[model samples]
Target chain A: MTRNAPPPADSGAVRSAGSSGSGSSGAGRPGFLWAVPAAVFFGLFAIVPLIMVAVLSFASWDGLSDPEFTGLDNWRTLLDDPVMIKSLWLSVLLTVLGVAVQTPLSILLGVWAAGHQRNRAVLSAIYFVPLLLSIAAVSVLWRAVLDPNLGVPAHATWLFGDGNLFGTQATAIGVLVFVSTWQFTPLHTLIYQGAARAVPPVLYQAAQIDGAGRVRQFFHITLPQLRNSIITSVILMVVGGLTTFDTVLILTQGGPGSDTTISAYYMYQKAFKSFDYGAASAIALLLVLVSTVISLIVVRLSGYDKMRSTMEGL
Target chain B: MRKSRPNHLAGFGSLVWLLVVGLPLYVMLVATFQSRPDYAANGPLAFPEHFTLDNYVNDLNSGFAQYFLNTVIVTVCVVGIVVLLVPPLAYTIVRSRGRATTTVFRLFLLGLAIPSQAVIVPMFFVISEAGLYDNLIGVILPTAAFAMPVCALILTGVMRDITPDLYEAMTVDGASPRRVFFQLVLPLSRSGVSTIVVFSALQAWNGFLFPLVLTQSVETKVITLGLYDFQTERGVDTPGLLAAVVLSMLPILIVYLFARRALVQGLMGVGGK
Candidate 1:
């Protein structure tokens, strides 16, 4: 916790004082005026709703009538509700699968792409195609492409992997995770690619001169150099994993034993389908609390705050 | 740097590049052309034997044109508002660096960790209560709201990367903070502006959960919602529905192609990964 205080005090404080001293009186300046709309917008929309979720979670309302105070009811139900708990479990399962699959694959591709400059532009375009496509379009596109009776999967289920990908519970969530990882792997690759390219070539040359093989160079030079990027991208992966809903909504609709149902999807179903705004709000607040804690832990363990603050000052 | 030979990667990678991304895009384009009967006869993967404008024509009949317009309106408004608003905010945060600035910056950073899923619960009530529910204005407000945090954060990183000497020179010249803002800050931060513009536009364009939950009527529905409903309505007509999908993707994809490098740099710059 004290880590947040370290680098900012050293550099940030100095910068603030230096700028304030060098410039004229800072209050009532033009820049602060420019920030007013932004601050207000976030207040009304971002932070206010955040507080609203907290309050609404403790009230009973159908989103139309007056919300009456209902302390601990939603929370107690959440604790015992198998559907919500299962969805939460599924979200964690997804986070694990996503991290496990995306991290190394992206690193490898990123390394390969970093060195393979001959087709860099073309390859980047190809890879970034998925990133550019709309999520809704991606959802429908994959649905058609992966259909058992209709598309590529119909012809090559053995090689293409699943024929009835969205149909069977056993393979449904796995397939959903795979398609998602494929679509998003490019983004992770880009991050890793940027990180890898930032490393100087001299490190590799010196290691090579020391009789370090390519694999050895990768482990010692490349991996260590990319430690921050890895950690950062893992945070992206975990947050993304936890908040996943569109793919499930469009592709599976939480079908085949509700295997692909994530916490977000559960919230969506409760609020939209069952029309239980109070319970849904409870889920919302819980997810935010849990995810905030989880992300902070990830950042702490990854040394992200320590590394990034120093990096920023540099 | 010494160049490495292609080895066998040339043939293998070329195939993969074509197969992995190109195939789905190809299927989509091909499926869009084949008539309904032709689609059924040849299946989803087969090339269209008789290509026609029927799917496209049918899609326009389904009010897809209005959906396209709605998407453009919302996306452009969100992007414009974000670009116009965030720079000044980012400038103040970087230039001042006071207690208020730092606290504000931290608040924005906290928004990055909190996805819109958490806000949608209360947001639904807020929008409906304000009588903005099922309205495009309703969608635009919240979309821009969610975008503000990340946009401001990225723009701050960019503005901080501005050399302090630039500010010093402007200050020494007796430049008003307003002049220093427009005459200096704006010109220097063109790349950053474009970065947030492309970023927010993408966010708005691809926004699903918001448009899905907030907008109820067809008149207010953006293209993403439009596309989803189109698929359900025309699920049997694979090519027709896909044609609509392709149409919805075209505008954003066109922007992406021209701004690909900048988009890549923007995403990387934001450290969003």
Candidate 2:
């Protein structure tokens, strides 16, 4: 893709030429030397592992011993397996549920917190607690909090009159989504709050002068202004949720008929449990495809090209 | 006609929202104090009639002190390395935009795409060969390397936001590049540096797949590994487990308690930009 592209802007070329010009004449040799370690580090660690993953994905063998030539076999298995197909669907479902739940909740909280700058610090602290904790801690915390026999849900049922409030498959999925949102919303809230705060107070005042109520002002002034952050946070959450493991591994382990077994969990089981490295690599490749597609969609929907060019050039 | 007072719906809504958000945290804290029977019998939110420091004391005996230390060591080391390494690279990228800089950053961006799950198996072989297989540094090095991309990406965004004129003026005043970085850029980018700290800390602390798959011995286990041990050894001990969790969360919680505003500000600045 880069082959046919125009050269980078003339400014960079001019800068490099000027640096080289100075170095040849022995005027500005000091600055050029400092950039060496960074370039080398990036090449060694970042560049190499990526090429390795691509190479390994096509070969066949367990992670131990030697890998043999097996072109297209892994990819072919991914194309045909029904379980693989189902997990893909489940991964998509998790992403959708997470994004659907988190985006609006975070936007609302962000708007509310931004509206009251006095309490913003305290409110942000409260919301961000989950984000600070690890996924393991979150899983364990929720496991204890949601334990059917000994959890808060049981007590809530005692007060509200209960049988089994969360034993159903839908409820199980709902709980996972809820935990994900709890972990993520504070982050998006902060993003939106920043975006909302950046919006001129004059805009809100102007709307108020025009008799726009808070609700109307939110739709008109807040949501539109926060489009970029909202989209960015949503993309991050969706990508994360689809690939989620630690929480599910701790909470459900994809239990009750494997209802919560997203592609990520399925991939782990297939690779490690079933000893199907070929299948796992295929699944990994497919995940990359799915992520790439989703990211492309986000880029298109958010007009990220325009955003990047506009934001980066200055 | 008498006009009614302003509607209190917004105030009422916010109060309800706050309660909804705060209730789960209350449950976690409360659960840590109650005995197993009390927790099992009364449900998670019950006020413990017999409040106990026993859970905390028992946990201290449960081999978590080492786990906590390991977690701290790994997390501090990862964050320290990432902060020290990523900025110079990111600074260079921001200041000197060219084929080489962009190529390096794009490689880092690939790290963003390459999930740890994909790399876990190969990484095990790599770490074991380095004789760091069960060492804390084993987990530390790979996690830091993998995290470099995102950290560099965020730092580059921040460093880019600094006005180039500052760098130009410093150079004219005979400050070297490293001097300009330490004196002018680093201080100016305090928010960005703190953002990387908060971010890298969460990544290292929360990481489970690496530590779980790579490390075997108790001496190398971090908090996530400790929790896994909690699950296996005392799986039914509700209060003990919760106590351990609360203990695990304490350090980051303390950091967040003070700097959440900075974190939010950082997210807004780095992420949104």
Predicted structure with the largest TM-score when compared to the true one: 1
Q: Candidate 1 — what's its lDDT?
A: 0.79
Worst 10 residues of 2 chain A by lDDT: A1-10
At residue A111, candidate 2 shows an lDDT of 73
Docking verdict class for candidate 1: acceptable
Q: Clashing pairs in model 2?
A: none
What are the runs in model 1 whose C-alpha is more than 4 Å off?
A: A1-31, A157-162, A294-314, B1-18
Error of 1 at B132 (Å): 0.8
lDDT of 1 by residue, B217-245 (tens): 98998988988887777677788888988
DockQ of 1: 0.49
Instruction: Give per-residue CA lDDT, model 1, range A1-314, as digits (tens).
Output: 31111111233343444465423433223434446667888889889999999998988888677889999898898889998889989999988899999898789778777765667657767777888877788989888877777777777867756577767776788777877887888889888888888899999888877878667988999999999888888888888898888888888899876777889999999888988888999999987887787666654664433322532342
Q: What is the TM-score of chain B alone in each candidate?
A: 0.95, 0.89
- Model 1 residue A169 CA deviation (Å) reads 1.3
Clashing pairs in 1: none
Best by lDDT: 1
